[model samples]
Target chain A: MYLKVELNWNVVIPAENLDIKGLMLQKAILVRLLDDFAAKKATKDLGYLVAVTTLNKIGEGKVREHSGDVLFPVSFTCLSFKVFRGEVIEGVVHKILKHGVFMRCGPIENLYLSNQKMSDYQYQFADNPCFLSLKTGSRIEKDVTVRCIVIGVKYMEAQKEFQAVVGLEGDYLGPI
Target chain B: MQNKSGHFDAILLCFRCRHFYNLTRVFFLACDAVPFVLSLCLRKIYSRLRARLKLSFNMSAAGEEEENAADLKIGDEFLKAKCLMNCEVSVILEHKYEQLQQMSEDPMNQVSQVFEKSLQYVKRFSRYKNPDAVRQVRELLSSYQLAEFELCVLGNLCPETVEEAIAMVPSIKSRGRVHDDEAIEKLLNDMSLIKKFE
Candidate 1:
């Protein structure tokens, strides 16, 4: 799901980007903010920072005594994609393994749907491998969109990424 | 001598009758005791099982083990924040990229991989393309008084029927007690109407 969250952060303007005119200073800060926003792609708290919608406030700059850099406190609202447990999300199947399949849902790339959860489907070994449903005769192969319920979510703080285990055990949760 | 022998046989028969009656009374007592003992054991086991089941039920209700749409674990900050559907996101990203291109000659370097991938994903999955249709869809779903998350899910997925919608988002049926099947059907109808017009 995509959420528009309000956040406050302090952005620093190096000596090189600093300018005398107010308009140029504002432009420099805005550019720095966007660059920083792009660099910090994802956080544990806010799944993935997609885009900055609006810049609300830029506070008075405080000069650093040692480095001659100006620190500005900024508040903005940005779009983030965070998947909660039990969220029914659709993902494209990217890789098919013997035990399970890996899918990419939004910014989350490591969504694992194990064969144990897909009781109705059997792993068929063909020229193109796929999980063939016995009841419906539908196949889940490469690039097929599958709707699954998030069973568990793990956040890697170091990597600023989320990994989830999804399941097709629920009603109407399967290949779409 | 014959009279004395007949008296002895009568005494022996009387003693044998008393012994047989005593054996039958003991057999009946054991049969009665068996069910009483079994019932006591069953009652103990049942009470223990009921307590355990109650504990598990309470845990599940508290959103420990199982998570439903109603009991989302997303932080309170996110719950209050406005949610954007896939279609809306596509519009925003496209506009941002356009703005970037207008501002600078090299727009590709300005945007990150996350931006490009997101733009692509939303473009592929976005159900509604027209901006007016997107706004109308949001307004229509909002009228139903769904949670922000639920509203976006329904918008993004665009389930054709109430049954499919309910299946995709179970909380709509279980959490929103005011919304019955007919109301949901009407909601779905309105959504489809907008899509049809779009």
Candidate 2:
């Protein structure tokens, strides 16, 4: 599910980080202060704070001389996502390929609804490269919210990420 | 008449706390000195007292079968916390939900998959009918200052008996049986709905 995650960040200011913050270092500090804060504060309750959409609250900035970094004690709300097996979720169709369609569901948005996951709908490449049901002529394409249940999820060996393989074979889980 | 002693005792508690570590060290040293024979004798005494207390070691053979010790890794602390005790389906679900949210792998990752499957089964059990009781138990456990793991177990297993609690919770032993028992018994008494059910 989509969520707004609020968390605190105390980013270390390396000289390179300041370089990322062009001219007005003070204004750029808040944006850069949140760097890797999500990764640091990832816990069971808070999950992974993947995106910092807004800086809801800000506190007094403290500059450390030794490290040459500014610490911004701020309370910000962002987004968090998680998934469960056999859990059905609705997401917008982000990409359509000849193989399968991807839905940016929950937090990760790497959920791939493969053809094996969709027993009901057959991929019709002649037209929109969408999942077309031979039974009802119903087709699913980009920008459409499709509901699917997670069947298999694998972590990519090379990347620090997860891939969710969802199934639509379950009852009432095609396009909704 | 009460006005004579009415002045709040502004006694410094630091002086008393000064010996806390020394006293704890002494106690541990004393325990370490106890011989195997003495430990066996103590166990005898404990079993006798437990018999008098009518504590239930009634956890079924099924529970033992469910606990496969070799599978759990060190960081899989949650599984160890849950294996020995009974917990509410919803509470366990919530705890696992929180854990799953932070995990890099899928919930079915092999490292703790047995426990995960067990949790999925446990979630189907109907134990969360009373939200009010659940909330009270949650607050009460935090008030008791049980460790995160202990609180998780306590929130799930609303153990009725002193022995059941002692068996299920390691903190009870750590806090000294008498002190923790009294507090936990009071907590269980207050949660009558959970106390009566199972």
Candidate 3:
């Protein structure tokens, strides 16, 4: 199971007494997080945690100097078996491409349903003349079941690439 | 007796001439006094009118000053609130990033595309990192005419690795537990901290 966390940026120092150089150093920490965590291999323990950071307010330009360090808190959440493959997930049909259907499961997130993965009934129904004539915005009112499989994961160091595989199968194989 | 009648008529005329002249002089003096008295009254009225005009002018000037003071006060209060909010957001982002950095084994190589895109926020914070950096970012943000300071911070906070950036964003822990809007709003609000980057 993955833990879910919510995060945002908060300035530890007041805007009237902020140090610009200090803020830069502090921001560097965020850069490190961007590089280290978001792109890494998914571990069983890590599950599927989503981290988020927000920026709320800023002081005026005239007095921003002498203001303390500007802080940013990146919040995150962990989705256990719910969002993983094989979990019964519900989503809206966002788009239909020549290859497959795309479902928007959550904000800023999307999933792809390849044509090959569609069940025979879905394939046949979609292939029908009436279905083929449907437009892009047409709502799909069908449930799909599929196992989550680690199709491909990539890690880049400088200009190098590394790959990792996670197998998602079993009851995690349906579309809602 | 015939000579006495002529002398008596001459004597009567001579005795009244001087007295009549004195009476005429008194009459002219009274006419002159009337005009002098009217002039004095007019002077007093003019002075009072002039004083009233001066008072009104002074009052208007004072009113303008009071309005200016009120406006300045409002602006100051608003800026203060804004500064506090920005500070909070920056702190939160820093804390979350630190936690993720510690947890990850290979902090450098992770390159999630989504995370990579999000790390652009680091640049936003870069504006507040230093005086010089803040100045530079302020100019940039101003040129773009952006209202939110957080956007500027995000512009400066680009991460070196994409995966690390992705890790910074909180993942969905469970279905129905987190609302995407709430998360995004929080992120946006936190990013506003860039307003204090100066």
Candidate 4:
């Protein structure tokens, strides 16, 4: 899911980056803010901070005593993507393993739907490995779009990434 | 005596919150117990516990599919945030990327991996390409006063029938049963109509 989240953070500018003109200083602050926003990536609260849609405010910059760097309190609204359990999501199968298939859903790349989760489908050891459904004879291979419900989600604090365990057990949830 | 009175005020506050929240969806009584037995030290613990309980409340309401992975929750902070459908996100990201390309000499460096992947995902999944169709879809669904999450799910998936819609988002069906099958059917039909015309 994509969310428009308002956030307040302090953006720091080195002494060299500061300009004489007010407009130039403002431009520098925005550039620094965008750079920081991209670098911050995902958070435990908000999944992935994709892009800054709008800059709502740039509060008065305060100079630090020790470093002489200026700190500006920036308030902006950005787009974020987070997936909740039980939410039916569509993903493109990228890699097929005997145990399961790996799919990418928006910013979430590590969505795994295990073979056990897909009870109706049996794995076939073809030249290109795929899961073949017994009932419909539908094949789940690389690049195929599959709809699955998120069964579990884990956020790795070290990597700042989200990995989910998905399932095709529910109704209307299978290869699309 | 002061602490006792404060405890009563907190309970009254919780009841008022429950009353207001009940109007929207099922109200969980889990957090109501926070203020039942309050002491100076216990009150501090209760405040922290209330925050934790509220987080769980939001998660359960979001539709947990299983028992063990109860930790797979998107908290209330995100629930209240404005949710954009895949088509809408595609438009926004595409527009922002284009603007960045025009403004900066090194636009590729400015864009993050998340931004690139999200753009590709949305572009691939977005059902409606036409901007007007997107707007129409939102307008049609908003008439029902569906939660932002539900609205976006319906818009993104564009489920053909009421049954499919419910299957995709069980919360819509379970949340006080505000939407009947007929209403859901009409919503789906209207969504398809927008897509058809587009």
Please provide, for model 1 over B16-123, each residue's C-alpha lDDT reduced to its tens digit, 9 standing for 90 to 100.
788777777887888898899899999999999999999889966765444444354455666677989999998888899999999999988878777777887898
**Per-residue lDDT value at B1 in model 2:** 35
Preferred candidate (DockQ higher): 2 or 4: 4
Candidate that beats the other on DockQ, 1 or 2, i.e. the better one? 1
lDDT of 3 by residue, B58-165 (tens): 777654443221122112322122211122333344555566579787643443543332233232323354444444444444443222322322343322233322
> Mind giving the per-residue lDDT tens digits that candidate 4 earns over A15-61?
99988899999999998998899899999778898999999999988
Using lDDT as the yardstick, the better of models 2 and 4 is: 4
lDDT tens digits by residue: candidate 4, B1-198: 999999999999999888788844543453444345345568788888998999899777544533321122356665677999999998898889899889889977778999999999999999999988888888888899677888888889989988888888777777375788989998888888889899
- Whichever of 2 and 3 has more DockQ, that candidate is 2
Candidate 4 docks at the CAPRI level of acceptable
lDDT by residue (A1-176, candidate 3, tens digit) is 11223323232434544346867644554454444454442333223223444333333323234544444444433221112222222344445565555544322234565555543313324542111213232223333222223233233345332222222222222332
Query: What fraction of correct interface contacts does each candidate retain?
Result: 0.65, 0.00, 0.02, 0.71
Q: Name the candidate, 1 or 2, with the larger TM-score value.
A: 1
lDDT of 4 at A106: 88
Docking class of 3: incorrect
List, for all models, the DockQ compared with the true complex. Answer: 0.40, 0.03, 0.02, 0.41
Task: Extract clashing residue pairs from model 2.
Answer: A5-A78, B87-B156, B88-B156
* DockQ of candidate 1 against the true complex: 0.40
In candidate 4, stretches whose alpha carbon ends up further than 4 angstroms from where it belongs are B1-74, B104-106
Candidate that would win on DockQ: 4
Q: Residue B102 deviation, candidate 2, in Å?
A: 35
